[model samples]
Target: MRRALHAAPEILANFVAPYGVYEMLAAHWGDTDALIASAVPPLLWSFYELAKTRRVDAISVVVVSAILLTVGATFMGGSARLIQMRDAMVTGVVGVMFLATLGMKKPMIFYLARATVARGTADGAAEYELVWERPGVPQVFRVLTLVWGLGLVVQTSCMCWLAWIWPIGRFLLLSPFISFGIFGLLMFWSLGYIARRPAARAILAR
Candidate 1:
């Protein structure tokens, strides 16, 4: 609950505020402009997070990269629909990155989990590093990474298909809900998966 409270500001900035911005501006500024304007909140939030942390981490890189991609796509001057499709493209790319890391010594989820667990403390970070060496820990992260990668890819595909066929207003109305739904399911599944694994449970108990 404390973590959830701490994350509320980011959630509002990235998802809620952007949608509100687009809705408020779309009528006056036009879709392309509104889309570009809506990117501001998340971009600002990403930079703020980076500044607050004063250290680069996997999650920070992903958030900043995704925001930059969105901004770049908007500036490319395509139709509003194309701008809307930018989120799908960014998500797909990140999903691919997750899958690509499967070949590495530690998968993408390992870094993400480590960052979350450490919470900016050196001792916590060191503890997680030591935990990584435990038997089954590596495999757990790999499996979690695979699940998240596949889930994100599927979500991106769905978003792209919707953006392609639906009208801009309708797409905008539904996309956020779709994103939240998919992500919520993925997170729920991850918690359940971790709960079932003794190694993962040990990490969580720490």
Candidate 2:
């Protein structure tokens, strides 16, 4: 038990390193103590709960920062910049997570969405979503995934780019507006794409 406990950090470090965030976050937080404090709880409560002991040990650091930004935005209402930066942070984190999922060639979202759609909740009241996977939809599904990934990259890039060019205060102040705009635009674009897709239409009809 002591050996396992002693090895926990290294085990976590090794597991998460392949996902490409271990060093970046370590650098950002720097101090191991601080990093552990800030980073571990979220992972423990969120990701770790879903895994076996030897599986992935750490949640994405990007996710932690994103949570900080979101909480800060809510609490720091006087500072619109915090809110904008918050938007950026949240979007950036989500963007990276989605990209990582893509990189892994994992279909976490596709499966979850299918499960939700097909069965709804276990209770009888849930609307039945069509669970059928037609051959025709894979092409569009792939395209949609690409589009979503690209959209996240674009939004994160926008936030980071603004962070660089604008004064720190300005970036913070304007981020909310920019973030909200991007979000609404993304939604519209997604809606249009889905609305035109035969699979989506077929799903709706079912």
Candidate 3:
């Protein structure tokens, strides 16, 4: 087990080393189109869950969100300005997602965090609605929503900045440290918080 664990880093390094970024994500997740299909369910589940306790609202996101995004990027492709700041493209898409959910006063992050709530079975969509109506949940979700959206914006901006100033390979070197540091802090904070609650800690500790 120790030997296998030690080799895990090499396995990951080797996987990405030979492939382009798009290719790597595709292969890792089984295929590129699979990524989109995989992404939609969680958001949809969130809506379905929230809609029960809250009023019935429109869908938060759908095909147009993805297509129009690509279209917008395509229009600016030749502009060179878009190409350089093109990293912001995904950020814009995510911001739009938050906006779409904002109309319903639903924050997208809590959908992901629902598992942290007691008895949040991912398969049980109705339970998400139940969770949403719990005390202080919606407020926590909105803060989570803002944090998620703002964090993505800042992260994307940093990526663009790195790509602009650094050479191609350097961004890879720098990004991991920055990401690790941020996640490390969050993880440490969460560890303390979760440790205090046995039920919530079970979910988080997982």
* Residue 45 in candidate 2, Cα distance off native in Å: 18
Candidate 3 residue runs with Cα over 4 Å from true position: 1-85, 88-92, 114-123, 183-206
83-170 per-residue lDDT for model 3 (tens digits): 4256235654675576466557566655545434423344444555665665655665565556556665666677678656764334
* Whole-model Cα lDDT of every candidate shown, in order: 0.82, 0.50, 0.48
Q: Which ten residues in a row have the lowest lDDT in candidate 3?
A: 55-64
Of 2 and 3, which scores higher on lDDT? 2
On lDDT, the candidate that comes out on top is 1
User: Who wins the TM-score comparison?
Assistant: 1
| Cα TM-score of candidate 2 | 0.48
Q: Give the TM-score (vs. native) of candidate 3.
A: 0.51
Q: Over the stretch 1-206, how does candidate 2's per-residue lDDT look in tens digits? A: 99999867654443433223423453565423222333343345444434432322123343455556655544544333343445455666666556566554333334434443444334311342232355455444455556666677788788867855675434433454676677788768766876887665443332
Instruction: Give TM-scores for every candidate, taking all chains together and pairing residue i with residue i.
Output: 0.85, 0.48, 0.51
| Model 3 error, position 149 (Å) | 0.9
For each predicted model, how many residue pairs clash, with residues at least 3 apart or on different chains? 0, 5, 0
lDDT for predicted candidate 2 compared with the true structure: 0.50
Q: Candidates ranked by TM-score, best first?
A: 1, 3, 2
RMSD of 1: 2.7
